[model samples]
Target chain A: MTPSHTAESARRSAGDPPPAELRSRLLGALEGLLAHRAFDAVSVIDIIRAAGVSKASFYFYFASKQAVLAELVRQAVRRGHEAADPWVSPDAAGPSDPVEGLRQGVTDGARLWRENAGVLKAIVESWGSDDGLRALWLDQMNSFTDAAVTRIEADPEALRHLGGVDVQATAAGLTWLGERLYYLAAAGVPPFDDQTVLIDTLTNAWTATLYGRRAADGRPAGGAIVDGHEGR
Target chain B: MTPSHTAESARRSAGDPPPAELRSRLLGALEGLLAHRAFDAVSVIDIIRAAGVSKASFYFYFASKQAVLAELVRQAVRRGHEAADPWVSPDAAGPSDPVEGLRQGVTDGARLWRENAGVLKAIVESWGSDDGLRALWLDQMNSFTDAAVTRIEADPEALRHLGGVDVQATAAGLTWLGERLYYLAAAGVPPFDDQTVLIDTLTNAWTATLYGRRAADGRPAGGAIVDGHEGR
Candidate 1:
């Protein structure tokens, strides 16, 4: 398995299988269950039955359904981090172009939302009432915020356009912006439900925020070469 | 009371008071309780006790706790509509600047969130699991998106800067962007929790989305006469 897929394996307990084993099965089962029913409606028996595991095996891994939720969130966040790697990488600053990096990252991020919409929706819904989930959610978002801040600060071109804007707050707000848009799209809310529109709108928002306005051709005015074409 | 304040009164049952009455009191009580506890933690008995009303009175006004939540969401949305009036007003197109209108509207929006954070948070958190709330929430959000679309389409100066951007999708994404940031600020999530930062970031994002890039003075380039100062 790729390193990103095995990243969750490090969290496994001493007795768990060496690879992503029963614990992953349990987590995957919960994710599958969320596709059709509300988290509150899904019980331990349902989860184990879906995974073809016993009640004892379920409890042996997750203390509760919420525990599985927390792990699913962690796993989702890891994948999110990997997807955004292009934006945060040093290579994004040079010939690679940060705006293009943003386009790639956002497209991948949208796909991530599409793939794990149910797990993400359930966890987000519960974060308000669950302290552990709330804290973990914020922490995961901050990682994205931090990555954005790093990218923005490192780019003089972007900074020149940002002017006196508060980088930290801007980054965090944009991070929350993406989270909310993705959530709305995943929930099949109108306007945002169209995946192509979601991706384009986000790319334009980020570009306009970082540069100034987009050119008539829909590229940021004077920042980067997009898909091998220079800005007008 | 102003027309905005009495907007919810029209929804009162025939038996309720002529003006803002016991139903409003129940909503106010629930809003108050949410400040200290999660919606799931606040029971009907707790709501009645907090409102100084009887169980019969509570059930007479609201079918269930979830019903109360739906009403609270409706009331909050009405107030939100009032808060965003400046952005959608025809005056926003002429002598009054749209960007400044945006500033005033965003400032009012952030304050609305601060005042109704707990209530709004509870409803938003529950929307995923509750079909009634999910529909109500979407309908409410669409109202804001409509306002944004109206404003964007009405302003030729703003359009000149927009180029080929999808007005409907762009406006919807920006609307969701503001909602998410305001929620984070109200929830006391970092960076966004700083009220000043939250308002500024939102204002900037809106300006950027509508006009391309903000100038060094933080006004949208070549668009509006912001606060009596023309863009350089």
Candidate 2:
């Protein structure tokens, strides 16, 4: 089967909106190109050629190459939110232990980043240079931070020891930390690319910030999870 | 006085090499432009016009706009290393408390990024897209990681609790985490710009990963610093 077959399968499985066939095709082409080349170096001609679409068609769906990138970033954000559901959803029966739930979230988030390294790398690298992309990324970060705040607010006991910490700002900082660390790791930046180290380091950070220690044994008094035995 | 006159003053005070006047002019121009616009958006004509130099002269000291960025990144790295001197210098009498030394390093590093936000933002945003910039950043990261490794190696007790963690990978991960977090903060990315939250969250992460807890109060029993009183 051809490459469009994969896109078609993904589209069908995800139940994309009607009339999005061409848009998905263009996105697929951009993804294919970005897989092997830096986003800045990939031009409109390259994207159209890779997508097997005409210039006019590309414009019909995207204002410019950056628009396409913004769209890709939007999709990445959606996937990221979905991946974070296991941990962020307040009602979800997440891992019995809060720390385990956070670790699971970190693992899933890292996997999502590894899978979409190309688009994520482009989005991260374009953070400051492209306002549209930056805004899109910032929007996602805000959503993640909000979810983190909710998580922390819902479980005051889990974070009671972090008495003076500004939960909102703390959530925001940790979310950005995760975003940057994962971007660096996914982009194959040295030292960050090692999956085990990257994920564990991130989990450790998240746990320490939210749970107040690296492990249950290391936790401070009154900072223990409700069901610490479930973590293992 | 002309802009170059100011640059000349900065050069002399900073002890820049002699006969590098024009080069400094172009760099100053680039810095001025970057402060107002993104690096990729700034053009060669813009640099020359801002510097009051001609095209040929622009090419005299730098091969391209990216070359100017590389120089700025190089200088930023040097400044970073200098800022990190208190923490990374092998022979220096660093903070008597390991956590205190780490906190001092994080604070100084954050200050350096805040001071050089414009150029550092460009370098970080250009990371992956430009080989030269990426190499420069990667080199700085590697050096930071090496220094971190050395510190950890030197402090067997402070980090003994982290027995299972890969110290090298851990160091690399933390270094990148700092880089990305600082970039976002300096670039004024939402939720990460709060100095107090960002630094404390980062310090918490670093401390947790290295010493296994959020603070001296929570530090693993056997992982106490040689002189905890000095930290206060």
Candidate 3:
């Protein structure tokens, strides 16, 4: 078969043709570039070249390079939310344990980041003092954490087992920690990617802060899903 | 007095003005434009105009706009380290308690961030992946903590008052918590800037996590300084 024929067959087998949306393609390109380059080093020309789209197409979708980055950030946050979707609201009910939900959030966060190391790393590590970017990132983060807060709020009784924890602060802290953790992994830092250490460190740190004296041994046992559990 | 005369007088009174450093002057100009404009929106022209330097001069000092930013980040990190210097190696052989030393570290960290918000925000919020920047930031943080850790190690007995807390992990957590706290403040989110709240939340939060309970019910209880005493 010709190369075109082989390409068509590969695409056909995949169920759907590749994304035609300029936005998706651009985001993909941006994500790909970020894996190896910091935000400051990459130029608009680089992004357009990597996207394999003309400058006109890129401008049609985004006003500037920064705009593409903003969208990239939004996409990463969205994926992070999707990661946590499985554990609490969808999987269990009635005083559902947040422990599993949290673990899934961390795991999914790690997975999405591993997949899109380029984009997430660039955005998280390259904060600027400009008010616009600051407002945009904070709003995006607030929205992501708000969804998590709403889920927990939906079943107030679900968190009742959490006792006297500052639910709002706890949720916020966990979300930030998850983001920072992913950033660390994307930066090629090991030990953080040590699934066992990650889960253990995160679980112990957060649970102890939330439950207090309950996780002192650095391990929460009994329905624990503790450190020894497979990270996958 | 002529405008030049006043400027000269101001310089003279400020101390024999040192000869202007070329790179620093360019970096300052770059930062001024950046502080007012989004990172992507600011261009070589704006930077040169703001600095009153030719494009050639700008290029001579820095390779790219991003390099200007990287330099600014280094400067900010340096300042942050200076802000925390007072507590890094305190005169006290060690605190009467280990928690106090951690407390000093966090408090010093908050002050440093507050003192240097602009560049700190830039370094912390990059949209592109920057291993170099992350490594720079991590190095600055580790330097500060390593100083504190040395002090703590000097008196293991003082650190031991915690009932066997993991000294190294505890130190890392303290540094991380401080960085995270200041990040919220630097975000320019209102209510989060309340200096008292910043100090109180970080100090109490660090105290609780390390010692199993916040020093004063999450409220500052007459810290040594009058202003940083309570976050409420």
Candidate 4:
């Protein structure tokens, strides 16, 4: 894996586009390195060595390690949107009780964080310092915020329940809330590190804030879910 | 301020300890630098030069720039606890409605973040890569989480309203939510950057999650606070 002259020989003979294959290898190597090392501690030299590519090839694909990190963050954000679709998508259908759909969505989102913890962690830790990374992060966050705002606004019941709370601000706050919780969960911080409890807590929060109070049976006033206790 | 030999003249002769003054100078220099540059960009040399202190004096007071950062974070967390007391303190007296106290606390917290934005930003950006900073950050977060849990558990009304939600985990999630929101506001991120909306949104989320549904008039079902519109 740590060879300098193996890039040409290691290429698969399966008619893979050479340039795309090399780029993928570099990306994969950086992602793999980030699993154990912080982005600051991981260098281009280390990435290429791990990718079994030459310095020239590594530069040909990426201007710097930060560039590769930006790409990883972009990919992760796209996957994050997909994972959140069950709850954030305005037309996505699910259980009659929307909170149950939310639970499922949050559950999937937590799993996504665990899988991409390395890449996400690097971006969260570095974005504040780098101009490009900061812009990219805020832009990605806005997408989630907009999706959440749209979903909530589309639900007249939820909208009526919100009262004086500004939808755009609340959506933005909730989006940041999810980001922080997922970051803490990925970093193995306590309470948040407990996945079951984390999901339950977030689902409850979302239900309460967006759907208003639940009845004694743990169902929203308008909800008729048969068994709230079954999932947890 | 940039003179190498000015540390001697910069000291206040008001019976302040020389060592303490020098340490404070170093800390202040680093904090000021952080406002303009990320921690990764601020070096020991930069700190000392800004402090107008010798390299040996810096090492004598603190082990590294990171050590100084740890101290700043500690100081900030202490101030944070004071700012949060109106809401998080179980025995703190307030308006007939507790949510008013929560609003005041959240507003103070936002101000605190704005004041310490530079130092707090540095910690958030570097903690993931530095083991000591990560531990310090997590420990400080746990203090907030514990206070939240204690406050929630003490309020039987709030407890009753929580339903199946786990208090400990909910407190942890809300604590991180506040941290993220404050960080974004301090960083001047949109939506959250609007202070009025930020405070109102957080107050609403806290009110709903901890106090359950508000009445049609915007007061929680359990209490009476006239004119919810007066503050906003």
Candidate 5:
């Protein structure tokens, strides 16, 4: 098994899995509620009511509303990391075109963000004020950066050109950039229009930074290059 | 005068300037207060008390506590725009080395953000929840982006290579990226350490994006290229 898979298995083994059905219901309820309102405005009672779970059951697995949101963020971060498989997975064969591989990774990452935009938005917006959320979000960012550093270290050619760049810091800065940009887009901020613009513009920045060039070829670098199904 | 200057002058003309002494007192009070606490946690009463001004006097010049914060944001934005003179001012003459010019701009911008880090942080963290603050912040970002776009458009060589890049969108994205990065740095978030790392990493990204290359020369890009005294 790959190191990443083993790591995942080890993580899973370390913790008692939440009663899957109740946890799923709570998460789904939070997601549904977040789709319409800001997270700060949502209350624990609201989550319990939406989940159709008793208060006692709500406390059975989680400690607070923040804990539930933290769990949701943890899931989103895992999904986001997994979606970045095109670039981060060491065992996965490198794309025939390196730049295109970077673009595909960015595109997939954007798609995942868009899909979970609500929960992701909550995490981004609330983290500044909520210590628990902030720690979870920071952990996620570091994990993504760690994955990026690993990918860069594994690829000799990419590593050569990144001589002066601080690999860890660059990865961290870029990761935060993607998060903030996608958050702004999801929150309906200006200049961050539809998904296509968000995806393309971000892919441009990522490709430029990592590959040292623009995605000039008009080829659609979204789906064809990366095996989108592997992570699932 | 340019359109932006005309707009600024017009804005100045629209309102009777606040009594210099009272305004200074209030601003100083707010700055002192913000140094210790989050903007949201601070109240209007706190400002008036700190300023040693009557409630009526506070209302005479400012509409709310938010108005005070908005004014601070406006001043910070104007200072930041001025600090970007090295890169954005068209008739100011481009630097001898283009990449160095870009680096200097990034460095100046970072310094301004660092100087007013507290107010800037308050604006960033609080704006997400407040519509008025959000609009003010968005206006600041767009103005910065407009300046960047203008700079890029004025330079024929940079413009040419930016063919695939939607110049305005690219500028806007980079501008937001800079804002978020600086915000993270100013907020003391992890991986964004001392001023050197912040300035260097950001300079690298800005130089790469605008020039389509890194700042390869080892020359000091901070003070020599641009008249640091121009904006002050």
Candidate 6:
């Protein structure tokens, strides 16, 4: 029924019917409700009244208020995933250093935060209380961490040069930093012009700090190579 | 007044009823509510019911749910400040050395987090939904940042070895890192076992990264100058 609720129609039974426009209107109204009032304060009565949809329609799409919140969290995460553009995976690379995978991960991570800040905020805001949403967050961030670790460990040459880098810890630390910075940037932290600057600064610092390497003269140097293969 | 509400009688009217017990109950109830539910989900009724206090008692202590949350944030901040053990202010010192100030700040910072993790989490969780809370977080975090900047600028001699440490940016960066790590540690981030470890690791890495030096390969290094004056 509504443009925003496109997926709702797809889930309806073959014989069942609700106009797409009404579905979209309901979704948009929910968004407006949440933006203006605390989610808990919003009632089903309030929702249907605002959407101009029947209570029957409300039940058709959602099981309960909690279900709506759950759906919101899911939509937020899905949007985050869609907005992402992490580093090219090591498996997909061609003659490139595997660590560039991490670099790409950092770049893509920053981009996702910038593009989907609202969605990200909704997810993180839910993290403290919503177990399912929290799990989703841990899964997504840990996946990135896992990918970084795999990239580091898979490259023998790169792993070899990491004499001091704690592969596991560093990966976890970077992922945590990215998640936190994502929130900060979404909240408009200064000196971070946009996600690009935030990503560059974080990746640069992370590369330098984790590797225990000094830049040539204090500025982040160009693509740092690991044993002349994977650039860390 | 619930027990917790009494803690802030100093901020309220002198003629206000001595609702000490009620204040405590309210604060304790708030703490429980925060632990169990998201900020937006926790309602005035929930807090009052949790405290086993009358609705009128709840209002007697707090103007609104937001008021309860605001007071909670303030109490948490005060607790954190009180938890700052051995944090010798630079002005409290015989002399000013930014490194010494920074070292103390780092140590104090870690100790504060280690001691008051729940408070830290409550404050952090409140940031996104509450503009006032976000401003408070930035101000509190930036105070630490400003301290680092002052120390860095004052103790220029201490940083002689660092050819180009970009004091201001480095201080801001380290402050951000410190606050970020505090949250991470509260959330059970591993490898950062205790306050000392976090303080030492973060302080060293911050200085090392800023000065283009390598972060040393050691833990638990809160050496002399914990007094802000070595060889005094």
Candidate 2 lDDT for residue B154 = 80
lDDT by residue for model 4 (B88-165), tens: 666657665677767777788888888898999889888878899989998998888899888888888888777666
The best candidate in terms of TM-score: 4
10 residues in a row with least lDDT, candidate 5 chain B: B223-232
Off by over 4 Å in 4: A1-17, A214-232, B1-17, B214-232
Give residue A127's error in model 5 in angstroms: 1.2
TM-score of each: 0.81, 0.81, 0.69, 0.86, 0.80, 0.66
TM-score of chain A of each: 0.79, 0.82, 0.69, 0.84, 0.78, 0.62
What digit string (tens of lDDT, one per residue) describes model 1 on residues B1-232?
Answer: 2334443443345554555366777887888899988888999999988776778888888899889988887888788787677557767443376666777788888878877888888887777777888788888888888888888888897787776677887888888888788887777776677776677788888888787656234444756433311111
lDDT score of residue B109 within candidate 1: 88
Which is better, 1 or 6, measured by lDDT? 1
| Order of quality (DockQ) | 4, 1, 2, 3, 5, 6
Tens-digit lDDT track for model 2 on B57-86?
Answer: 788889989999999878987988877866
Docking level of model 3: incorrect
Question: Can you write out model 6's per-residue Cα lDDT over A199-224, one digit (the tens) per residue?
Answer: 54565556555544432332256554
State the lDDT of candidate 6 residue by residue for B1-232, as single tens digits: 5565544543345766564767887887887776655566778888877877778878888777767767776776677665442243445543254444456566667766756565567777666666676787778776666666555554544355333433444455566777766776667655455444455556555644555333332333434323322221
DockQ, per-model, please?
A: 0.38, 0.30, 0.23, 0.46, 0.22, 0.18
Q: Which stretches of candidate 6 lie over 4 Å from their true place?
A: A1-60, A63-88, A91-105, A154-165, A193-197, A213-232, B1-25, B28-54, B79-107, B154-173, B189-208, B211-232
lDDT of 3 by residue, B1-232 (tens): 1233322232234443344444665687766665555565778888777655677877777787777788787777777667656555656464655566666666677666765566666666642335565577777667755765665566544354434344554455456656666878766553346555566556555555554454443344554433211111
Instruction: Look at candidate 3 and tell me the lDDT of residue B26.
Output: 65
lDDT of 5 by residue, B73-183 (tens): 888878877667667766577676666677778778778987887788888887777779889988888888888887888877777666656676678788888888888
